[model samples]
Target: MPTTNKKKQKKSSDTAVQGTNDSSVVSKVSAASRGYFRDAFLQHFVCKVARRAPLINRGYYVRWRAVDHCVRRFLHITQKCPKKQILSLGAGFDSLYFRLHADGALDGAVVFELDFPDVARRKAALIGSNITLMGMLDACSPPAAGPVSISSSRYRLLGLDVREESQVEDALGAAGLDWTAPTLILSEVVLTYMETQRSDAVIGWAAKLLPQALFVMYEQIHPHDPFGRVMQEHFLKLNSTLHALRQYPDTSAQRHRFLQKGWEQCACLDMNHFYEGLVPEEERARVERLEPFDEHEEWHLKCSHYFILTASRGSLLEQALLAPTAGPICGPHRGPAALGVRPTSACLEGLGMASARVRPDQVLLTGGSSRGGRGAEARALIRAQEGWRSVGVEPSVDLDVRLHHSATPLPGGGVVIYGGRSSPLSPTPGLFKVTFDPCGSPAAPDSERAEAAKVRVEQMVCSGDPPPPRWRHTASVVSHTGRDFLFVFGGKNQSEPALGDGCFLSLDQQLWMKIPVEGAAPVARHSHSACSYQGGVLVFGGLSGGGRPLGDTAVLRPTDGGFCWGRIDVRPPPVPRYSHCAHVVGGKLVVVGGVWTHSDGVPGVVVIDVSTRSSVEFSLDTTAVPWPLMLHSFCSELLDPEEPELLLMGGGGNCFSFGTHMNPRPVTVDLKPALGAGFPSWS
Candidate 1:
């Protein structure tokens, strides 16, 4: 690339970075409008107010809460100081100064915000036009002059590029910054947009200039996972790549970067840790109730990818800096010596679909929302000498468009699919039992993608007490006496956040009947895994009513009368997860892929030996699978009745505004490496 072209590219990238300020302010205004936080001045910066999804609202709320927590802590710590300061790098349309002034938190403290010249000028113009914003500003220095866009006694907004160290230093000095004052430097999602070398120079410059400082930063990390990949690609498309993530990919590496630059003490925590450890339980509950949210998988993934960090130099600020937390943290993110597994394609893709093995070489899939949108039709993954291929299945009856339902194979044949929804408004009602063609789906030898199969469906009308319409629940075939029953358990409906109630549908009698269910029930949860164990079923992790993942493994075993529940504790405990699939083969429970919190890596395979009371977790090697192998909202089935192999189909979901990511094809995992020997030797 020529130097002239490089300069133009850099200029264009800088403009795009400035444009981010506009979008960010709009999101902040939306979050404030929804009452996630109190920011009266943010609305003035945006031309219009648009409502964001609850997930995005929560994302911004956590970012706001983390930053506010640090700011308040800094203010409280230096309350007695005659002069203090807060310098926000790449500040852009932020309403921090006015909000602080309105709250009367900045008495002797001064705020200095620096961004690209364009963003600063726009922010200054917005402030000058708003009577409310101008009212909060100091009357001594009216808004706008030169590079110093808005100049006031308590607030100074400078329009200058942050990469130029000498320029910013001289500019801050001219704006009345006390070099020796107790300063809190905030950089929220900034710095990462700059080149890694430039960002490093900026970090070094800040540490070298501010002797008594507490640096607070919020930025992206873990750019290699499925969600992280989508996040990186989103920025790439915008031509503003996250350059810092390549070098500083996690909390530890980020903290190390600041320390290596010049800071003394540093501590970093992902948003998950900050939300769980710092935010009070009552406060979290209050914020959660403000909106209706169903995107738990994406929410957790978003939290895991972004982080909040605090690094300090002076002893006074070091004592008050964010501390590194370990034991007090919540969620299931324990990094262990990993067991690696390889990935292969099964040639089927979608999300929230239910899968069941209807034939030796055929797996029935029904009801999921894909990138092409949700359809009432069903698809089948037909296995041959090659790999599994998906085929369109024509059902005798019209199947309603639904996702996150349960498909359980009956002992006789076919599958009973129950309870799913088109959207979060409510769970869809009714149940259907579909039996596939005996000879397998007919398709051309080479054109599996363009062929159709046949299946018979019937609406099963049941009597007695049917379970409330719910999706993301488990419907398993549990045998009692000589009869097989479709045991329904734990899922959430629109009216309820989580459901713990269980119901039994007798497959023989074709009616919902009462069954003696003994022992203490697990907490209300959704997106759990239940597989047939002995004569009953073993239930695993799920998202609880409190919006946390449950890791406890419980078994409901037959004891001559009915069934009894017993909790099992496996050594070397697997991380708690939900939206995964499980199967029992030869007394061992094979668990594969799901969404988890706090951890940096995506979920893989976790195998538990029921007889030995032991468990092991293995990370997937997705080199061969060209796309990101997101494992949530997906379905998996055993390739063989007795083999320890799983054919996982249709995973991924809307990745929290980044975009929708669907596993382009089904993936197969050979559990033999994890269960029998150990991880396979790639070498």
Candidate 2:
């Protein structure tokens, strides 16, 4: 009777241990699922990396590369196949199916995932609870309540204990998995938890089920090594055992296990080799620089103890799995180039200003402050090459220091500088003509070209009374009545409120005439953006008289002699801000950074479709910029019309401090695929 009691006690102890192990496995899966979200939030991955620990983020990255490489290889090899399928064992809460669907890779593929009952149920609940995740799945039919298994058009989630061969077969059958299709089986650090015999049985079962399949496994190895021992001990302390690691001790043993278990061919590689050799160098560099890292020793040790093993039944599958091992199949492409800083002897600064591309490789920059000083009445010629170089800084004008000025490029050549603040308490209402003579005689012997580049600035004597002295206005040169006219609109005079008036200075007649409008005019505002578009001027976002940021948009259509104003209703308008930069590109208004209140508003680029009244915002990688301010003067030029590479230059930093000055270099943003052209490139 005592012996019988001992047997009962032993059985009870074993059952308790089993229950604890099951809980630990689920806990580990939960932790990894959380890690994915954390990594995404932090931007560790191109998709997302929220706020994950650096070590965990980096580790996850390595794991992602291994899995992605195998999947990509499978897809590449089976491109000609009519049907392709992927089965993931112990899938946990992975979002691979959704990610692939987003990438458009799941169009002709079937994805099936199997996990323990609890883990599968929890993952399904999480997905069902979140609208974002649920929307990714093909919701042809309503999901069942409290479902432990779910099926979509291209994805299926099922629950089954991988150790139980019968249950695994039943789940696959119920999920309608195609065993005859070219299949890729993924087992990431899952089989390590099962007994060696159970793992082997699972492997053998897959090999027999799928005649043309590639089984890729990622898990720990070399449990007897010093580093491996530490890893094993860590898992042991977590109440989890590396049961399969002792059986497949290293990559060689792993390969042998696969080949001996009915796999026609097998290949194995440690994570260290996989990372340094198989992963593209460019991709590695990009993620490596995402955050500051100093865990070389730990990284190498951890990677060295893990291995990626691929076993295949068919020659095509074997070749596909081994092809990437030779080298990276897909290397990273070069991002947009910075093209170096804008060459300037001194920094150009101001709140509202102008920059225009007058020549193919040159832009004329005028009327901005230098360092902490007020706007210097000077013009700089910027030449674009491998790097931007200030080819010449013309002599400073004798005119008063000006800020919030307008420099409109003439149709013939040269620029007309209009009303601006001459001093803190004064406004310069007079128009100034600045011309550069490329063929003029030499003044000095520095060089023949340098001597020929002569600049002449002179104040214009108009025929009629000009508009009252005002600053923070917009000016654009438009063709009106068979001649060019400089149109100025909406600004503030000293001690006055914002003005809603508009006027045109006829270059041919040398006469300033008041612009009579027929329709509703834009509200009185300053620091708004205006660009000539389709024989009209499009005005957007500015600061109102009450110092409020305004998001109103209007257009001034050229009439027989004067102008007609019409307001535009934009859906999902951009954030209200002033001193933002805007340019007409591809029938859309591309608005860059701006200032809101006392802070930098949106640092991303906002593209608005004028015809459709729709808008989309693309956030800039903050790491790419020197500062976080929006009131900087910037000039953009579309270099490639087909690819549409827009190069943006000269923007001030977050603050007005001496250190947070304008950036000298140019940053290129590609407007391809997003704009229905191609993918964006940034340098």
Best by lDDT: 1
**Per-residue lDDT over 1-683 for candidate 1, one digit per residue giving the tens place of the 0 to 100 score:** 99999999999999888878877888888899999999988888888899988888999999999999999999998998899999999998888988998899997999999998888878878888888888787754754455788788888999899998888888899888999999999999999999999999988988898899999999999999888898999999998899999999998899889999999989898888788778887888889788767788988899999999999988678575465343543333222444443454455668888888877777888988867565535887776656666777778887788888998898898889899888888677788998887353334462543343568899998888787898889999999898899999999888787999888899877889888879998889999999988888999999998778777899988878888888887766678889888988887788888888846477787777776677767777777677878989988878775566677788888887788888877777766666673421121
lDDT of each: 0.83, 0.65
Instruction: Compute the lDDT of residue 580 as modeled in candidate 1.
Output: 89
lDDT value for model 2: 0.65
For model 2, the stretches where C-alpha displacement exceeds 4 angstroms are 1-353, 374-379, 438-451, 597-601, 625-647, 653-660, 677-683
Quote model 1's TM-score: 0.95
For residues 1-683, write the lDDT of model 2, one tens digit per residue: 69999778645533443444344333333334444322121111122223444455566677777888789878888988989899998776666787787777765888998877766777777777766677878843544443237888788887666777887786677667887889999998788777689889989998998999999999887675334555666667555577888777877789899988899998888776687667776666656555543223245446657788888987667584644444322211222321222233333343334566655545556665655555644444444233344445474466566666777778888878787775535786568887765452223332444455666778788987777788778888776667777888897776655888778888988898765668988889887888887667899988776445677678888788667889777756666667677778767887665544211213356667777776665655535444332324455555555666565655553220013244545566656533652232222
lDDT of 2 at 465: 72
- What is the Cα-based lDDT of residue 370 in candidate 2? 57
Question: Model 2: which ten-residue window has the lowest total lDDT?
Answer: 37-46
